[model samples]
Target: MNTRDLQAFVAVVDSGSMVAAAAKLHLTQPGLTRRVQNLETLLGMPLLDRQSKPLKPTAAGRDVYALARNVLVAVDELMAAGAPDSEPSGELRIGVPPFLSELALERPIDRLRDAFPRLTLRVTAGWSPALVQGIERGALDVATVMVPASA
Candidate 1:
């Protein structure tokens, strides 16, 4: 019925259970269940087969799911089409991990160049601590740093 409802239904289907779906959607289990229930009510048909283990969507749900997915995809493309950030035209300084030896970062860099003709990118490979410091000091615009599990 709505984008949120469609997203909820798709997330539920993709995740395969109310609890898992709830976690994926960052909603409470009962809240997610209510969304699905509400959707069913709106459509006047049960979208999920509650009687089955690892609950599956009903036939109507499948049809709705396909359309909902396509609709969401179209909406995303439409939204992206008008976004000014898509044509980013600024210099960027980013840091990567120092331990990475000759990182295979060219493909993405090439893609960025193709996407933003006027954008300039400067990259520095450094230790996480140094990268974080650079970011905090405004020396680097952005940095990808790995946080050790121990931290």
Candidate 2:
């Protein structure tokens, strides 16, 4: 199966309409529809509920959606792994304390951006406990936490 076809199917499901998906992908509606159809044909099942208003995915489609998302993310990471300079790509979710954000993150964040132009940074400022919780829950890729010296 073509990855482009999977991407088109995922985009259509995500955007809830072929028109929006196509617009997001910079392709014509017919082109996007063709891609989805190609995927469906390959899988031998209908992935979409055509009669539904918001373009809900069928049972098989839901499974495909979840798997396709994993596949796409893996593909992106694989590409980044082979990238020159070993520059990281994809989203970096960072959690930091409010004090650190205000006092120390500015220049470091700028440097990170300069170093990894393809990386999308999402920074959240929160308390140490909350930031640590985010890291534990996999909601954050990394976080800084401070503990009392006596503790």
Candidate 3:
């Protein structure tokens, strides 16, 4: 429910054991266990299969893990953007044709970075079809593609 809980969950998932996760989180094993237990209690579902040797995420756990990752990313972005100076500080996913991505977008991207140093720009270059697909899949917030000109 909280960032700490999500962080613990992610640590456990990544480390594949409470002891390992505890070490990585700098918490006692019991403390890490309590946090995971509390999270499961709060969600009314077990996030990890304790019976498993290396710990495996249940189906619900996988879903919660994915959501938690996104939530944490958003929270970090929010904090960065909320800092004084009113500069953008979040991921801006964009897709562009290969040629434009290499040439046209360079100056504009440079200007954007100069204007907002904290911003993280993610640029994906591809042909028109792939760029359109990226946009449709939400992987890209905006896209520029080339098309045949009509005379």
Cα lDDT of all candidates, in order? 0.83, 0.93, 0.88
Return whichever of 1 and 3 wins on TM-score.
3
- Backbone clash pairs for candidate 1 read none
Ranking by lDDT: 2, 3, 1
Candidate 2 on 1-151: residue-level lDDT in tens? Answer: 8999999999999989999999999999999999999999999999999899789999999999999998998999988777766767889999999999868999999999998898999999999999989999999999988989995
Better of 2 and 3 by TM-score: 2
What lDDT does candidate 1 reach at residue 118?
71
Steric collisions counted per model: 0, 0, 0
Model 1 quality (TM-score): 0.56
45-116 in candidate 3: lDDT tens per residue?
999988898998999999998998899888987887678666677789988877787878889999998988
Q: Which stretches of candidate 2 lie over 4 Å from their true place?
A: 52-54, 98-111
Q: Distance (Å) between predicted and true CA of 16, model 2?
A: 2.5
Score candidate 1 by lDDT. 0.83
Estimate candidate 3's alpha-carbon lDDT, on a 0 to 1 scale: 0.88
Which regions of candidate 3 are displaced past 4 Å?
Answer: 15-20, 86-125, 142-144
Model 3, C-alpha of 92: deviation from truth (Å) = 4.9
Q: Pick the candidate with the highest lDDT.
A: 2
lDDT of 1 at 95: 88
lDDT of 1 at 28: 94
